[model samples]
Target: MTAQHPSDVDLFAPPRRSGPRPTTTGREIPHDQLDQFSPPRIRAALIGHATALPGVFTGPSQVSEPASLALRLHDPRGRWEAFLYPSPDEFGHIHRTGFMHLTVPRPIIAPLIEAGWIEPHPITLRPQWPDTIVMLYAPRDEDELALATAIMDASWQQATES
Candidate 1:
């Protein structure tokens, strides 16, 4: 057997096409504001799922222009650390899409595509935080609200009892 160098692995592969581009309702809530609504435990719970969703990161002061939130997601290939822009201005993409792309190394994009967690979107770099790629998910509907409320209640109950 021959020894393989860690650098020998090929990283990037073309993204798999998605069916029917995702639609957005243009609804949005800032991550800090979410603290008033019991935080985002709903999204936090999915961290263990096969295709993990990212979590919102908040800073000390209220988010102003050019704000960014660091996020963590899991794909088949590995864990990805990304950034999401929850600002109300240019970074307000989260308000529109309900999700944001946190760019992974070129190599990890294929895994995210295969896992159905992300697809290609506009790529822009923030000078302050060079590693972040943002994507916003679609706005939540009534069905999602009910489901989230139920999940949060169940989680709260479990936590209190434990």
Candidate 2:
């Protein structure tokens, strides 16, 4: 038997062409018009809404992930109202997944988890927290977008209702 180097293994096969490739119609299509509700687009919309709130500030996240962002809301009493960012995994690693983290009242966490709008933070495995629960959500579908919006609204209320 001969030893095989890792590079010698064929991990993927090139595409096999069965016929002439299909061509698009002459009508021009803009890039952004395709998948207008893609994850990045949804993220941008969320950031826009969050920043429009009173005393809310937007900044690059200190956690150092590629293309990560954060939002901070401060109340008049010199206390943090809310902190929002992308949720990280249990090992404290973040991917550019559409999941998010919102620090809000413990009360708001449970129902959202139960209703299937979000999942309990993957790190802690519980809806309540010493560290606020990270929420897992996807704004891919209409229902999901509605649920995500509701969760954001609830978080905003929890932050400002003090």
Candidate 3:
């Protein structure tokens, strides 16, 4: 009997795509199209606020999948504060998903999950950050963005203060 390869199994797992994941649709959206996938205005505001924070650097996520264009927030001490990226579904559709991923504290994760604001990361996909991260659902308005931002801020505070 021939040995089964890893790729030949796990049909239930999320499909992995090559190249940079698109912010919306299968293609990369322009910088101005940030709002299309989620709340456009809120997305811009959140990004602006994060970038303006002291010691926070906004750039592509270093720890994410290759060619991912996630907006990574780094603390003053050079630690990762959070990551904001389009949440892809199992089929790999990046556009119109309206969800986002954030890395935050374990203590606050439960409430977010319970409130339907976020969901726990899949252990199989992110074993490294299982208990410490949550996927922020589509923040379609300012209120949602506010909550997401607050969590991100807390993540920064936790990373820096510890």
Candidate 4:
């Protein structure tokens, strides 16, 4: 793929997602995040972690349905891609299921997805919802939380440090 369409290169190539893939309704607006819900404490911790990131703020999603918690970046690095968003670029958002929606870099995507850490957002095939936007499944336990944190760090590094 050309650099101009860097995101198009090997976008879905893989080792493949490890283990069982989680269930999703495959609908963008009502993107299903109901199963595998994180415990309340864990959800709170995730929100705290997501909110504390530099250049980010938490608020109602401008585009998502009501009550959706979204994190918008003040000045996005745009390393994920300068693709248009329904609103300003979002860094990520935590869902009721403890899942996260993030703008992850393309190169690391295969490893992350193949590792069973994340999956493509339900509507990734749509013109606006490119594959760069991925869904990070909820961290189910402390061990998974640790993994989740590392994944967030990696996602952020790709977003800000690339």
Name the top lDDT candidate: 4
lDDT of 3 by residue, 46-152 (tens): 56656655565544444344333344333333233333222221101112334555556666666655555555555324444335545555555655555555655
lDDT of each: 0.30, 0.41, 0.44, 0.65
Best by TM-score: 4
Clashes of 3: 2
Per-residue lDDT, model 3, residue 153, is: 62
Please list the residue runs of candidate 3 whose C-alpha ends up more than 4 Å from where it truly belongs after superposition.
1-37, 65-98, 124-127
Q: For model 2, what is the error of residue 50's alpha carbon versus the real structure, in angstroms, after optimal superposition?
A: 1.6
On residues 42-111, what C-alpha lDDT tens digit does candidate 1 reach at each position?
3433222212222222332123223333222222222222223332211112221233323344445445
Candidate 1 TM-score to native = 0.30
Tens digit per residue, CA lDDT, model 4, 1-162:
111212222334423333476777767767666667678887887787777778777787765655668877677665535322555556667777788777677777778777777877767787756577777878766555655655565555555553
Cα shift from native, residue 148, model 1 (Å): 17
Residue range with the least summed lDDT across 10 consecutive positions in model 4: 1-10
Q: Which ten residues in a row are the worst by lDDT in model 1?
A: 88-97
Name the regions of candidate 4 deviating beyond 4 angstroms: 1-19, 79-84
Q: TM-scores, in order shown?
A: 0.30, 0.53, 0.56, 0.75
RMSD of each: 14.4, 18.7, 15.1, 7.8
Better of 1 and 2 by TM-score: 2
Q: Candidate 4: TM-score?
A: 0.75
